[model samples]
Target chain A: EAGVTQSPTHLIKTRGQQATLRCSPISGHTSVYWYQQALGLGLQFLLWYDEGEERNRGNFPPRFSGRQFPNYSSELNVNALELEDSALYLCASSLAAGQGKPLHFGNGTRLTVT
Target chain B: GESVGLHLPTLSVQEGDNSIINCAYSNSASDYFIWYKQESGKGPQFIIDIRSNMDKRQGQRVTVLLNKTVKHLSLQIAATQPGDSAVYFCADYLTGFQKLVFGTGTRLLVSP
Candidate 1:
């Protein structure tokens, strides 16, 4: 079976610019998750989308936003990017929020802000 | 903020030896605890998971032990191999919370 897939394996942006990352969940998964893995840091939750709605969010600023499509794919948009925003943005999917199932992750999009 | 964390940043072991990576979580309300293995340039892969009601779960060559009493979690790999060298992370979540809190991770190195 195909796993979660991410687009533009690498992204380079400048401060004040905007960057968008995309993710396609597994064939049957309905919940999508976005996480940020900074240098020497753990994975920080970004957003959660389920059933085409924004179900939950992290502590990040409003500049970090995303949406889930009808097909369960997701897109993360970071506006007014800063140097500290450079990190590996990961996307994951699973059965659902209440299922307590393991999440399948994409290799991730490496975003480097200058 | 309270979150899951590892006891060590790195661990070195010899091939054929048993390896144990430990983690501590502060969220007693978390209903699910999981372990992930991440290799260089790759996303984390699910190693195993255990529900709060259960104390242990075992997979192919991995075992996860949850000690709710002390709010601790541990992953054990038997007969560790060089391929097992990677960053292992422990994460916890509460059902319906919609967020998985991951630890800083422990880099396990296996020498053949």
Candidate 2:
């Protein structure tokens, strides 16, 4: 079984621009989660998509949004990106949301907002 | 305004020694807790997890202890190795919610 996979291992965007990151969950996983890991900070939950619907989101602003596709892949979009948005964007997959199962994470897309 | 935080910014231990990282959570209602290991430039990896109903849970060489009374959590790594040098984060699942609250994380350094 392949693990979670993320696109654009590294990305660079200017301030006020938009950044889009992608993720592909494990073969049989149905839930995809997005997290932001800023430098010197912990992983902050961004969004959770299950069954093609967003089940939950974190305290982040509306600028941070994402969607899950029919195939269980996910895309995280950051609009009006700020310098603080430079961080590692992680994607994880679980059997389902809140099922108390361990999440498998991808290497993450390192976004650098200039 | 609610969150989880680490008591220490960093921890240094000798190889073959045991290491313990501590975390404090503000949400008393959090029922599920997880410990994750994140390597440099990589994503966070699941180390282990424990539920509110259990006080202690053990993995191969890792152990998680949860103290619901004080809303404290700890991860103990036995015989720490060089590969264990990374950041450890403790995440708490809100009661009846799927969102996970994560801590600031602690950097573990195992010196040979």
DockQ for all models, in order?
A: 0.54, 0.51
Candidate 1 Cα lDDT to native: 0.91
Q: Which parts of model 1 have CA positions greater than 4 angstroms off?
A: B1-8
A30-100: candidate 1 lDDT, tens digit per residue = 99999998866689998999899999999999999999999999999999999999999999999876647
lDDT of 2 by residue, B36-90 (tens): 8989878888999998999999999999999999989999999999999998889
**What lDDT score goes with residue B1 in model 2?**
20
Error of 1 at A49 (Å): 0.2
Candidate 2 pairs with clashing backbones? none
Chain A only: TM-score per candidate:
0.97, 0.97
Interface RMSD, Å, model 1: 3.6
Fraction of true contacts retained by every candidate, in order, equals 0.59, 0.57
Worst ten-residue run, lDDT, model 1 chain B? B1-10
CA lDDT, every prediction?
Answer: 0.91, 0.88
> Candidate 1 residues B1-112, lDDT tens each?
2323334488999999999999989878888988999998999999899999999999999999999999999999999999999999899996567689898789999999
